[model samples]
Target: MMGTRRSVQFGDVITGMLVDGVDGTPYVAATLLVDEQLGVRLEVPYITTSDTAAGETPGEWFETKCPPKNLLLIALEGNISLFDCRYSGHTVRHPAGIAVGKITPADVVLQDRKGDHSDPLEVKELRSDIDGLTEWTGFTAITRHPSVDDENRVKKLDIELRTTDELIWTQGQADMALRTTWSCDSTAEGLTINEGVMLHSTFPAPVPVLTHLEEHRKVASLMTFIFGCPITWRSHSVRDQRFTEKRFSQLIKQNTVKEAARPDPTEKQLRHPLASPSQIGSSGLEAWAASYETWGRFIHPAVSALNSPRTTLENVVVNAAVSMEAAGHLIGEVDGENATYDRRRRKTTATFIYRCLARTGWDWSGICESRVGLARALAKNYNTIKHYGRGDFPDPLETYLVSSTATLVVRLLAIRQAAPDATSEFDSGRHFPAYGRLVEDFKNNGLFIKCDGLFAVSS
Candidate 1:
């Protein structure tokens, strides 16, 4: 029951008292500073006493005290638990006889504390809204109708809809729910409507906040995989059902450690998601979750590389190629035919890529359009850059195409393995135009013929 208030943003400063130890320990007045890229830091100022005037400073205090690595900061806004904090540096004011030392935390948790407790608060449920999740879920909670006067001029509009909260999946002692919430505001200028998706997790028993956070991250990663974007938590709140003193006291707003900065996709870019809830259906989602749990070691990094905004084409190509090779080995282990053949001779990277592409039932000829197989061409390019200093580098444009095609192939293989029924939906979706574009680019650049020759020399 946390109130609808704006959450803390980067660059905001909160004044508080830093606690070094358990009860009765002396506290230092400090300020918590949030950074856009460098994460959270605590600044504590030290003043010189009459006897030690100009002799002791904040740096000396830190060195002498050797404060606990993990400290707590208590403030009016909330209590921040700083973990793995390290002394960054100190700024001295010689004339004022004061110095301020900075402590950077590896992890930070900001939470509202309602009452005093000897032990840490236990979290029973966590609810978080992810950016771009509404579009990814494709669940609409609002309908609009325009009203016009007899003059045929539109005067007002009527909006009607029902909020949806449905249980999505359940495992032993845990379950996940999807909630679509909407809000409408009428202003002087016009009416504004906003819709968002909130993911909720309920545990059988109350657990520590860190445990709840791990659960939240697991679901967020799944959303990131399906949404085909770097999904971030828009808001997060936790509740303990055991606390029944008041509605507001039962729920607390919390912010975990900030994630690394990455490029956010535009609205248009989000329109063409890799997969949607509506397209995949409930069964498909369950399958996807299972697949991810089993194959995440191979799948996660590839998806991250493909969707990363700051990486080079060479980096993306290498990551995608490695993932494909790993996935191919996994596939061979499960399929009897491939397993038997592998016992005689280890499968090549090209063979693995070729087998994965075939499983997707996707026609590679459309993109490759080369005498050499698509797998061989991709493997050759991967080796060219992976084993650099041995051969002439590929053209930049060609490398771009190879990176794009390899990532797309990896995506296809993932979907085919997780939800074969959704392959048709994916083929007819936004990827159709993308596939066509790759074909045209290859033809225009004459890479189709050149790729075949490149493969021939490597063979």
Candidate 2:
């Protein structure tokens, strides 16, 4: 029976739940010491790249355990500040982009101390008092996730000797390979290993467990990236919005609106080209939300203002129409002579959707007002897009349309102009566009409309 200690030490036994995933695997957690002493005392030597050697004494470069294929080596001192794992991936080759969750906790174990395996007489357990402790501390520390084949299939075993001592084992290592049990035919078989198994007694007994944390850890790091820089969001926002704006600009240059780009002019299409235009509209709003949510408080006031009622449906329609026309004008100018009907006609067809939406009291003016607001919102969402200016706008426009099914704009146009009487089908709503399929359709039909339910093309 494990004895209860008055206080837990860095090596004290901790009981945590094991989260089993889709395979015959289990994740276990144990209290372990994490600090610089633990890093240095371990005999394994490591070389520090200049990028990671910040404010530290330069030591002789030593070949530690040849880094496991796809594994990164980390060094520690005597502290566990947020900085403990900060410099894990700073090299140009590794870049700060390396995912750190794939490395197993067991892989970070310390060799057992010769005679210190006994439980300490009086151990006081360390309690975490910091907010969001999960983000910085965990019994199972996955130092890094290397891009290795079938990384998920590997097993990691972390054996604790004390609150501050741990031994790590994995299947891939030679001298440190873990000893594992294979239960077959109701009989236990001796585990095979290339290296001698090293076991150590830790202050703690059962370990605290966390499993399937690779993806979660990546998410946490990404969150850190956002919190640390805030500008990354701005950069992405700039790229995405600029991408859209550039596409819009391209549409303006190309000018010709091909009929094929429009929704099939059938009874079904007349009612709901693309399919669920409303959902597409909602998606645009959601995209705006996702972009803004990542930036926190670092956005312009006008950018934040998108949440204001100025984004009413009326505003969306008006801006959408105007923007569509602007896109169309751009397209026409760029591809006026001998322009492929597929591309040019598609732009024209898209504009037609705006015209129909306007005729149906869908509020085209509101969309126009919001166009600038949308641009502002995008600028707020992404700073890079604003500064860089998208070289080409058509692609991003297509992305937005595909994501929101706004490309049903063509089908909507066919319904309004070709067969207004079939307007009742509009109630069916718009569906999201299948980008590949739709693009192909646009390319194939060249001004020919494929009529659906209510969107019959007359001319």
Off by over 4 Å in 2: 1-315, 329-454, 457-459
What tens-digit string does per-residue lDDT give for candidate 2 at 1-459? 323221212222233322212233333231223232232111221234556554221121122212122111221211110101112221222433222111112222111111222211111111111112122222332233334347565355543222222222221111111111111133267543221111111123222111112111222222222112111110000001211122101010011111112222223322212222232232322232343333223222212221122343323333334433433343333312122123445433333333333433232221223222222222221222223474432234323322222323323432232233333435433222333344444344321122111111223
List pairs with backbone clashes in candidate 1: none
> How well is each residue in 53-116 modelled by candidate 1, as lDDT tens digits?
4423344546454445667777776566665567777776777757777887654545433444
lDDT for 152 (candidate 1)? 96
* Candidate 1 CA-lDDT value: 0.64
Number of clashes found in candidate 2 = 99
The TM-score that candidate 2 achieves is: 0.17
Cα lDDT computed for each candidate against the true fold: 0.64, 0.24
